[model samples]
Target: MGMAMTSSPQPPPPPRRRRSRLQSATTISAPSANPKPNPKAKVIPLLSDVGRLQSATPTPTPNGNPSPNPKGKVLPLLSDVGSNPSAIDYYSRVASNLAGAGRLGDFLIAAEGLRAASGDAGFAARINWRLLSRGVVAALREHGLPHVLEFLRDADRIGVHATVMLDADASDAVAAACRQLLDERIMAEFVEAIEALARFFVKGIVDPMDVLKIFVRKRDPDMAIRYARIFPHSQLLLCNTMEAFGKRKELKHALKVFGALKDQLGGINMFACRSIIDICSHCGSSVQARIIFEGLLAEKITPNTHVFNSLMNANAHSMSYNFSVYKHMQEIWCPS
Candidate 1:
């Protein structure tokens, strides 16, 4: 011990090195009754950060309200369009523009909106139906019959009438369209299409007789009869239809048409009489042929040689009737 004390007064052990507060806190993990939240831990800002961000944003008005944007445009509502004159004008312009641009679908939509808002007040008059019809007719000429038909149906639904006079080209196109419908066996649509075509006659755009000729050529008996009834004064149509029925051996139809012609024309003409005589000859109806011949005489319609020949031919199988007809023809000719 003496030796140690004499060893440079044995410098007291170096004072224990003191740890800094940071080092002590990091190194120490002591438990507590009320554990406080970690100060150094990351803190996610909830309401405070959101509030700060909102406060930083610039408000349009001093009263914390947003002002209308000068560059933003608002479209008028369809419901309010009825009460708003400007809205009506705006939609009308839109429709006109769309139509002018050849945007048919868009034009239709705009037009429908306007129609619902405007009601029946000059609805049809306000539109250039002629122009619209031209477009549809052009489509029909292009063999777009199905599309045009659907478009017309939709237009009707929206209270838009598409009535247009069909020109020569349009008439031909419509005929072709009808042929297609018939080929497809779409009878209902075919009837409707024909009715639509007939409407052109009402407007004096197409001749009903011409349409009858078309139906005759197409061998559409129903349509021919319909148009014939519509234009009862069409003598040529009636004659042709009767001749067609006779050729097809449709005796019933031929007789029916002949009777109608007689009633409508106030009397049968020489040509019609000849046609009926020929039909009787073909059907071997000697009795009917005799009746028609007598009727022609009673009407003061002089029987021609051709009419007499047809009457004889009708009774050719009956020697007695043939001889009687020949005797009558000789008497009439000799009666000079």
Candidate 2:
């Protein structure tokens, strides 16, 4: 018993070791006396960033007035942005904004800025000429003749000639403008302008024949024929011009045009043959009509009733000639 009691009293249980609350929990780092901020964390605006900021800001009204806002503190306008933007950045942003807004009048004004901006390296080619041309053509269609002429004049100024021809609406506007020019007695200028534009007809975006028709209807058949010769496969226009010559009794010119079509378009369609025969009949050239009829036969082009009638009428002075054409038609129609 004495020995057990001695073992129990041994060391009073070595003073129950204790841990403080601070020892049990995580410790926070103390603040440095001179802390350094992270340099990489700071943001510097880029050219595009500056552009976006400006674009996101409000723009002044067209009349040089600020638009009213009932809400709290109005945002700064684009004009209010400081002069930190580069020329390319500034003009590109302005042109893009104006064009997107469909503000053609404003876009034209801004295009001057874009033209200036194009002087910078790699900027001229960066512009979307297709988009630019579309905007300009839509503007022309909306504003009509005055704006169409304005666009033509400014195309060179704005460096858009290479792109303007790619747009169908632009081509239509040009045709309309040419007609206007002709109506205004500006024939020499119209001719010069159209001749220059005709080089682009191979693009096939605009039909050269449509433009030629404008001149033809304006009584400028010589110019019409000149342009028609440029696109020889434009058979309808060539025939129309030949018919015009026939109506004017210019048989030599009509025959010359018909011959050009025959040479250029690789023989003639029924329409062309009919047109030439009608012209020959009108000019009372039975020999020329007979030659054309023989050529049509050589080409294996079946003669229609109109062709037979034209051939017979061309030689109406000779009953034998008329009877011969009639007999040929009967043989073709009734193979018996």
Best by lDDT: 1
Candidate 2 lDDT score at position 324? 75
Clashes of each: 0, 0
Q: Mind giving the per-residue lDDT tens digits that candidate 1 earns over 59-139? A: 379887877665444455545556876656655655655544445566677677677666744554456544565566656
Candidate 1, poorest ten consecutive residues by summed lDDT? 47-56
Write candidate 2's Cα lDDT for 1-336 as tens digits: 465544445555567667766765545556788889775573433232434553233557999887764432422333332342454554555565555444555665555544553443334454455566676566666765455455555554565453334456656655676677666766566656555555443344345655665665566656666667655466777887788778877777788778777877786667777788989888878899999898787877788877777887788899987887778778888989
Sliding window of 10 residues with minimal summed lDDT for model 2? 72-81
Candidate 2 TM-score, true structure as reference: 0.45
lDDT of 2: 0.63
Instruction: Name model 1 segments beyond 4 Å from true.
Output: 1-59, 63-74, 95-113, 128-143, 165-192, 201-236, 244-253, 259-278, 281-284, 290-336
